[model samples]
Target: MTALSEYERLEAIGLWRADPQAQRRDVILSLGDASLVISDAKAGSALAHWSLPAMIRCNPGERPAIYAPSDEPGETVELDDEVMIAAIEKVHTIIESHRPHPGRLRSFLIGGVVLCVGAVALFWLPGALVDHAARITPQAKRVEIGRKLLTELSKMAGQPCTSPSGDQALAALSKRLPGHDTIVVLPEALMGARLLPGKLAVIGRNAIEGPDTPEVVAGYLIATEDAAAGQSPLKRMLGDLGPSAALRLLTTGNLPDSGITTYAEQLLRQEPTPPPTDGLLRAFRSAGVSSTPFAYALDPTGETVLGLIEADPFKGQPSPRPVLADAQWVALQDICTGR
Candidate 1:
């Protein structure tokens, strides 16, 4: 909007109607959480949505659609009302005039300098950091971190995980793993699975027991382990440790083991953010798992993951892994659906 010239501002809002949807021509404006969502109120669905924060109206209202400089064209709406048109223009002017405080600008510059320094260090001495991490983040510590993450995961899931099917599903998954050890599926915190040092993988009950084939569960488990391979889970633990403890992890290969529990509690209450993409891909491929199930879990659209779908290595390979042995599979399926 700030980029819009006075004329473009007038065009940004107006009646936008598509062919075959003429009856639903609507006066639209895009706003709301992280989307430039155009509501075709009469059509009963969003006409178009552009992911937000990075989007801006580039050409104003040249057409019923405008795109950001770096984004694709997004659907626009009709705002022919003289009053609304004038208001949008005024708003744009106000926005352009509002500048950050000098203090804030100084802070931003200082922060940017620090970020550059850190980035250089991260790249210049990456080996040192990774080596230091390896020393500080031992297997035993990762296992402890995994446990802490689970406690928080359960809380975020918003319900107790006592379903017999969920329990049975987890138990079945445990049987097919790389290690011969017992695993307890608890509630989720940061993600779906936690690989303990002893080859024990902890899963959230919802993960394995969802409306998915066994492949989905395997894909997630492998991905989590791959994440483990890159760094010790203590980075995650240090995430909850605040700055002082993070410095400790950086300088010394140790943190107070007691800090692990707080992370676990946070996991139960909320989810951790997603992992880096390269790490995700490595984990998925190493585990003999397809990207299809995980993609679907993130989004159900067949088109969103069309590439994964086309390259589905499992296509015509063989049937998916059963959730359990014949008897166990049947029992586990009925665990949630009811007998």
Candidate 2:
């Protein structure tokens, strides 16, 4: 309405047609605080009032502009006065800028609730609060958070490599890991494998390249999954975000974007902690994958990974199933090459 203050009570001559079939008649158009009043030119009586915000310009960038109150095709006003046309445009811009966008007001309300909860949680037991939040967090939200982390990680490690054939091979490999749906292959930056929220597992280029077999990549996948099972990825992420952020997420269902980005950058610079050897071996055994290749891949000298080699699950026996078809394995190996 501020846009209309300067032109308050401004009047101009316009041609008004109450209906498409009706003949146009000269009228006096006066600008009110929030409406355009149409008055009969001869009688000087108000004929119609159009809400300024609801007014729609029929033809844009044309001289002698035409307008309608809403979308009604029957009624319209044609004004050749440039001042009136400019004023209408300015008032509409002001009204739109002040109007609340759908969902945006709700988002602000949620953020406010989170801020209040964060203030209270700032003095409570942080660890217990984070655990409660992670336990109750929805799967859909977890996936969204995991995607944010992946986007941040991409900035430092480069985007994930993908190819039509390679994607198929990755999907086939993911079937081996229970509950896992995504296997992100990074060309560089990551030290090994790490599990993300929402059953996503990420592996470094080293896991696929070199003389390693498909079983070796599967071993890493199983290991990361086991590690995540021992420690929930959501809890891990919330812990890294700190208590205030965790409480905000618990109350408002969101964390600060900056925190997620920082955690992703930190992840790239540090190595993921390896899961227990017994647990990793059990996972490999359950999947019918030999641990020998993975053991050597971890340590070429084999001095540190002797237990894995000695207790090789599928040693001296044929693997119950091939990790991937020959062609699939070939494609997976080169997944990070061209792309």
Candidate 3:
């Protein structure tokens, strides 16, 4: 029973086979709630039921369109009837449109429960609603929000530095970090790396151009990732939006455009809090990157970052894997210079 009310009870004659080796037999195909029911033409008894959502059209654009119950190489239905083919296609499209993305179902169910809890807790607690919204927000939705915020941030920080060689170099450096999808090297304004709502990481020009090797940039990336693990970007954003927007998010699952704009401006003006040393050390160890270079870069005196310098992950071990090639590091350094 899908949202396609008009296509319900649609019946058509089709030929079906139980397996690829089996002979084709005539059958009556009836479109039922979220499934296609194939019944024996002679006995009128159900033969096989194929879930519409799992239905795969094989040999598309052919006179006799063939379909399989699923991607598995067995049990196919062939329909030469144009009316039946069109009906199946239409129903499939509708069902696919209504189907939730992979993780959306869980997010929706969890969000529902969290929203109820937040509603009751909002009156007594200050940030319960925003925290709940952040916890329940799906990864897909967070990516959308992150993209929007980045667009706004660009207005202030300027567009990310891009050049043919520089782009390739940046891509090479990004591959060293695990899980980070999009990493942008900003020309100026930013002082360190910051993780956005999605798996987007932005690094300052200094982090890229100032370091002799790509390990410094890698260190910054790892630090930002560790920071995000400690405090999610969505939770920080909700805090910036205040309690009213948080309440609205609890009910509507979105914030106003003005709130996003204001927050984006605020982020451009401020530096993100540094992640704890223990977590950052773990990240460096996991990535097999030395923390000494990044530590010196952060504090040339090495007075404040003594812990990072003293406990370098690959200090006494054999040389770890190179972060990037010599040529790539050179290209990355000149990314903003347009050379």
Residues 1-339 of candidate 2 have per-residue lDDT tens digits of: 444667887889999999989999999999988889999999999989999989999999997899999997878999999888889899988898898797998999999999989876676679888889889999999888888888888888889999999999999988866767798988878867777888777888888887447877877777777776666788888888888888899788998989988888877776766778888888888888888888888888999998888988887244678888889989999898886
> What's the TM-score of each model vs. the native?
0.44, 0.61, 0.59
Pairs of residues at least 3 apart in sequence or in different chains that clash in candidate 2: none
Scanning candidate 3 in windows of ten residues, the lowest lDDT window is: 311-320
Candidate 2 lDDT at 151 equals: 84
The digit string of per-residue lDDT tens for model 1 on 1-339 reads 433343332323445545324554654554433344565556546667644434455557654343332344433444445554444445445664575579888999999999999988766555554455645565665565455444444455433344565566557667765552545555434346665433555556565567346666566676665655555455544544665565565676455555655655554555434566555655555545666776676567866655555565555232355435555544543443431
Q: TM-score for model 1? A: 0.44
**Comparing 1 and 3 by TM-score, which wins?**
3
**C-alpha-based local distance difference test score of model 1:** 0.53
* CA shift of 173, model 2, Å: 0.8
Residue 204 Cα positional deviation in candidate 3, in Å, after optimal superposition: 1.2
Model 2 CA deviation exceeding 4 Å by range: 1-124, 316-318
Best prediction by TM-score = 2
Top candidate, metric lDDT: 2
